[model samples]
Target: MDILVCVKRVPDTSTNEIEVNDAGTDIERDDLVYSINEWDNYAVEEALQIVDRVGGSVTVAAVGDDESDEVLRRAMAMGVENAMLLSGDAFAGLDGRGVATVLQAAAKTKGIDLILTGAQADDGCAQVGGMLAAMLDQPFASLVNMIEVESDKTLKIGREVEGGEQEISRIELPCVLSIQTGINEPRYVGVRGIRKVASVEIPTMDAAALGLTAEALAPQVERLDYFTPEVGAGAEMLEGSTEEMVAKLIEMLQAKGGMK
Candidate 1:
């Protein structure tokens, strides 16, 4: 069984310097720190765990420029067998559909049996995994919280729904799964694993190598601009005795149409 885990390198959200450019609809690259998307890391860990249990190879792949190599190397350091980086100018400024096209091309080349990805990426729209499944003409299950390999060809997955309910599903091989965060505790890179895969070469593939065309890679959506939201002033605190506070709450609610 071969599993392909899709990972993404995103700007660390903790850095206040990271900002999106309004002109090009791209992330402001200056003074930026890159790390794997937290959710996608979980997906990689999950894929590794499954492959470890089932006795197979796990390959981590990413769609980005040269910066994405670090993200793939990180996954390899965590026990993935190999890594692939999909690149090219054609892949730039791609939305969900374009990304899916690239991933589908890579997966097809690898003859992957199962594809795992985060439910959404942090930097861009979160629709790539499902769109990739659609482009590949394969089944997909999103928001997966738990996954069990029932056999070499079947997988049982659990998804979370509203009201704390869960929807369980069983899917055959060659399907896509957009996993939820916290599905498993992602493992830290040990000294040995890091040393072993840190120097491992990551292969690069372009649109031509992946059998993709610029027209076929057109984005389904377009971004106009981006800007930080203006910070609003703090709300006034209404402090008083219990009875007085209740009256003030009623008045405030009425003023805001809560009682209308």
Candidate 2:
């Protein structure tokens, strides 16, 4: 049950307002607090749980610059046995496919029994798990919430489908699983774990070492613009006495498709 969980570092947008500075292509990230992506936490915990039951190691990997090392240490604090940082200037501005190519190349060389990652990054652009699986030429599942490793090369997995329904199926191993949140509760890193992480030295691998050429790493799609969505014209506020407010609200609602 040697498991490799791919993780990411993303800005903590919940606490701070994001400002676009790179001509709407990216955010001004220097001042933002960064952490392990929320979805990756679930994936890491699930890997740890499975490895705990089956007896193996869990390695967490991240793709980012120097500051991204913090999140890898954080994952080690969560009990991952090892950490890998896939980084290089060549990795900058990589699209989802480019990233999946890097992860696939690295994983192929290092090797693992199962691969797990969040269904999507907090950046909200891609569902990359399937992309990695496709590149690896293995069975792929997305939005997966449950997993049962029936054997070394077999997995019975469950994924969310339509209308709150769950679809479960069995697939062969050496496959990638895109974890959906709620699969399991992610454990909080305590002081002891944090202290351990502080003393750990995670390895760094340049994308070039992964055998990725600059041309191959180029993004497939280009961003035309990155502007904050405009507020809807119909959104308005009513300020008045309670009776007047109620009347105005009712009128507005009636004008729309609400109660009269």
Candidate 3:
């Protein structure tokens, strides 16, 4: 099983105080800490575990500028067999479909039997995995929480559905899955691990190398602006004795059409 896991570099929200740039078109990136997206980290770990059991190779790929190499190297440190960086001027400012197109092109260059990606990217629209599957015309399953290797050609996967229920299905090999977090505990990548792969060269591909035409790389969607919406009404604190508070809450709920 040759698996490819899509990853991304994103702002470390926990460590960074994210703010909108003065222009309001994007976040203030200056002086920000960057790291592999939390969800993508889980996907990389899941891919590693799958390869460990099935005796296959795992490759991690990212679509970004030179700054993305760190995220790819981190995955390599986590035991991925390969890492790829998809970058170039032509690849900038791409929307979801555009990203899927680039990844599809890269996947064709490798013998990938399974593709894994986070259910959603921290700074993305959560549409790449499904779109990539559509572009590649492969089977796709999202929100996957469990994976069982039924055979070399098939995989039994568990998905979290509505009402906390799990839906299990058998998907064929060479399919794409958007892995949900909590599927596995990601292994820690310490300084030693990172240093080991720091010097390893990661191959970079551009639109020209991927045979992507200018038209194919064009973004269909455009972001007009990105500003925080105005704050809504403030919350009302129900203060009183427990019984009195319950009565007030019920009255408020009834008045608000939330109850009879």
Please tell me which predicted candidate would have the highest TM-score against the true structure: 3
TM-score computed on alpha carbons, candidate 1: 0.90
**How would you encode candidate 1's per-residue C-alpha lDDT over 1-260 as one tens digit per residue?**
78899999988888647666757466677878889998899999999888878878999989999989888888988888889999999998888788888998999887788999998887546688888889888899999999999987899999989998999999987899998997999999766876777777889999999888889988777777777878899897889899998999999999999996
Give TM per candidate: 0.90, 0.90, 0.94
Worst 10 residues of 3 by lDDT: 117-126
lDDT of 2 by residue, 1-260 (tens): 88889999998878778887766767777778878888898999999999888788998888888888888888898889898999999999888888888899879877688999998887686557888899989888888899987888798999999999989899998889989999999998987888877867777888768888988888988878777777777957889999999999999889897984
Regarding TM-score, does 2 or 3 come out ahead?
A: 3
Q: How close is candidate 3 to the true structure, as a TM-score?
A: 0.94
The model with the greater lDDT, 1 or 2, is: 1
TM-score of 2: 0.90
